[model samples]
Target: MIVFLCVRFLVFSFVWPFIGGWREMYAANDAIPLFINMDYMKDPRYFAISFRRFFKNFLNNEDLRPGIYELRFSKPEKVCVLENSVLSSERTLDVIAYAPRDLATENGVSFEKEIYVRGSAAIGQNNDLRALVCDGDVSLAKNTVLRRWLDAEGNISAGEGCNLGVSLTSGKECLVAAGCVFRRLYGAPVKAGTSRKKSFALAARDDEERVFPPPPLGAKERQLEEIWPYSDTRFSVITPNRLWVGANSRILGHIKTYGNLNVDDNVLITGNVFAEGDIVIGQFCKILGDIFAQGSVSIGEGSQVGRPGKIKSVVGNQTVFLSSGAAVYGYVTTEGDGRVL
Candidate 1:
């Protein structure tokens, strides 16, 4: 009995390691691998592109002419296709409407689904919409409420007291009137409370060769003692305290401030801007690069960020306010509210 017990113990000890190894290998093989592609999902036009693809594929399988029809998808989906322009006023649309030409809506219209217009689109006052995609220009009247997003291949104009929803993007210019609110905006040049012609005229009238004032005396003594270098621009300036730049001043380098930053009228900054606190930009200023603020940001009238061909960003952790005639070439975003005044 004693010899048998010793043999059993040895056998069990020798086999347990092999069994555990096998179990570990099996568990590894049973594990699932996950891959996530966030680029497409993060795109601002993701919904619009996806819907366009689906509609095109659906059209390919059908031989229906231009008219209103009930499409049978997983569920019954209503569709309206118009060869000529669409004029829907004081009505409710529960269908996905498509117009190869222009589209116009009157006051008190409610759109429950997406709309696609190959030509221009004019949305009237007091309208509620889900989404809109236009190949040409788009104009939204006063007090319109967009629930999802709006995208245009040409230009976009939103009137007063409009809610622009999650995202508003334009291929060319984007003009937003007063009392409009939005989350994200992207465009070649986004102008608030001004027309394209007027903005251009203002720019043209400004002195192209105007000289910028030199940096304030004893500026270096006031700045934080750290000298950070930028690889691309090779210019950086840092301040540990509140920063205030006088009118018509020019900063040839990037500015980083720990406290609030205030710039007076007609300032020109050649590089990026970073502020831990609130940032207030005065009128007719031009910032060549991005602006990032941990607190709220207020852009004064006629200020421009980024050049015509270049793209830049203005991002505020809190609210972002754009005064009349302010322009951002690429993107304007805020975690809280974004308003045009």
Candidate 2:
């Protein structure tokens, strides 16, 4: 079943490429010209040249069309709409990648070398991602470790129970809030253990063992949150409310949440980011959202929250901490006494 699913998904990403005659349509503010074509003595840019070359051979017509050729324009008014339009030819697909720029490149794309930008970030990963999904309403907690990204072609929300600190690569739009913590950074192998402690040394090699990265120390998943290729180590839970505790605030008693969290106000939260695991948020944290950390919760200042919601505990070994001088305005929680300085 897993194998079948994998194959199906791989095909799913390109299924739209087969749509017939959708690319020839022209998009314009006014009616499309009865017939339109580009005839430039010289080439435009690297991308433009690539496009002309693709069309010349998209149907295996190497020289059927010249760098500047004539073609009929089917859809005119809808040219602007092509941002979300489907692909009829290779030109269309490359020009208008996805419906949502944040998810794909159907709208506007700025490419610098191999790096491409759709929404507010870039897409580049040097690791294994069976599949990264950022579909539907998804949010990224302030500091969340996204072992895998999702919905580069759909809407994915972020907030609450974030801060995993792992490498992140976007396919679509990855929403990140404030006061959230992401720990993972791509670079040298993390120094772990000591002479008297555990030690691990890794160098790039060619082998399954060398290729397979260690299981990520990812945080649990929160509510209303779903990622492609789920990570098994992170926490997942729903939140009801939160009592934020910042570095400049005071903390007391075990923290407990039933809704979501939004810390930022230089206040004190008597809870940790994770005590259980599962977590979720329904609020729109200006800076932060729900938290589902497994160890510590440290949010930045001015973290926001979503609608009326509370963060709940689902696992253990959790602690929610926030950055110094951070402000919170949403709900938060924990199960044991917490501290602030």
Using TM-score as the measure, the top candidate is 1
Q: Compute each candidate's TM-score over C-alphas.
A: 0.78, 0.19
Candidate topping lDDT: 1
Among all windows of 10 consecutive residues in model 1, the one with the lowest summed lDDT is: 225-234
How much lDDT does each candidate structure score? 0.81, 0.28
Q: Per-residue CA lDDT of candidate 2, range 270-320, in tens?
A: 234433332321111121223354444544322322211232222212443
Model 1 agreement with the true structure over 1-341: per-residue lDDT tens digits: 99999988987888766887788788886556686666645565666677767776777755556888775656878888866565667888889888877888888899898888878999999999999989899999999999989999989999999999988988899999999999889888888995675443222245343433434433433454332222122345688988777776666667889999887777777778899999998888878779999998998988888777767999999989999989888999898999999
**Residue pairs clashing, model 1:** none
Give the range where candidate 2 is weakest over 10 consecutive residues by summed lDDT. 186-195
> What's the lDDT for residue 284 in model 1?
83
